[model samples]
Target: MTTTDLLNVRSLSFAYERRRIVDLWSERFDAGLVWLRGPNGVGKSTRLKLLAGALAPQYGSATLNGKVDLLTDPLAWRREVAWVSAEPPPFEHLSPAELFGFLAGLYPRADRARWELHIEGFGLAPFLRQPLRQLSTGTQHKAALAAALALGTTVLLLDEPLNALDEASLVHWRACMAQAAASPDRLMLVVSHEELGVTPTRELILKP
Candidate 1:
């Protein structure tokens, strides 16, 4: 690992219904974009959730910046990470604006101005005032992304974020990812089935 490597996972394991999904998983991520590539059942999403501190590991730990470990300092680890799940935000009754407002309060580093910039960049302004339930799946996904992007976290985990974007939105978001990848202090991990539109710094493919 290089000096820039900040995110580390060691001997990680997790299961569901007594069935193993990730077993003996260990990896270290340095600054830049790393695409977690794999087939549908390869547990890419599960790994992201583990790295994001959204799910507890049955054994092992994820540490960030050498100072925060998922098991020993979960809240700090979570604060240093931002995640965009494959699913849309679940607050059906909240408009994008309302959702951002709530999330901003939760993340002390959230930038409202940055969120607005992402909204404009993704062409999501027209749907900002509409409730999430009223938006298309793609639009809702964009809304979720805007919020996450503005969180200013050191590690950004994205699960199939390009799933339902239109051509224009896709282009802008790709640019956004590329820009973020240029940062020397951040690690951006994207889980995707396709790599056509992204210039990943490196890739880790999980075999089923």
Candidate 2:
């Protein structure tokens, strides 16, 4: 493929209940925004999870930066990646401030100021100190988005990021995504059912 550092997946396969979801799939993800679009049950989320090293592949391998095998060097791969899932943070009892601090610890190089900036941009300041459970789904999603983006990782993975955003927030997040995509060194992988309001550099569409 292109002479760039790529997220390389080869002969990748996975299944649930003996039913195949992704079957011997292979692709290369390079820098800039790449939208993974597909209908429900097409394994878009599963592929994202596998790419983020959140789920172990049933077979085959995925490599990042040419040599970092996600299956073998998961922690190393994660160190350079940031993932935002469709679901909110699991620690509903934790406030956004606490959760952000925890994430900053994991990503020692995280930009806390940028995180706070996004928090404010997303109108999450009032909810920052509130427990995640007390925040609305959209607000909680904002918290996750802020933390993930603030990490400033090389690889950013998002699953259904636009699902719970308000119209204003959605526009703002789309701008943010565009800005992030402007960077040639950062790779953005997003799984969405609708247009993100920004053109993706590439797209991969799966099927049932």
Q: Which candidate is the best by lDDT?
A: 1
Cα-based RMSD of the predictions, in order?
1.5, 1.6
lDDT for model 2 comes to 0.85
Per-residue lDDT value at 56 in model 2: 77
lDDT, candidate 1, 40-128, per-residue tens: 88899999998887789999997888888889987888788989899878788999899899888878899999999999988999998
Clashes of each: 0, 0
lDDT at 42, model 2:
90
Please list the residue runs of candidate 2 whose C-alpha ends up more than 4 Å from where it truly belongs after superposition.
none
Tens-place lDDT per residue, model 2, 1-208, is 6474667889888888798888898988778898898888899988878787777779998877787887788788888888888987777899988888888888867998999889878888888889999989999999999888898787889999898899878877998888866767778999999888998888888877
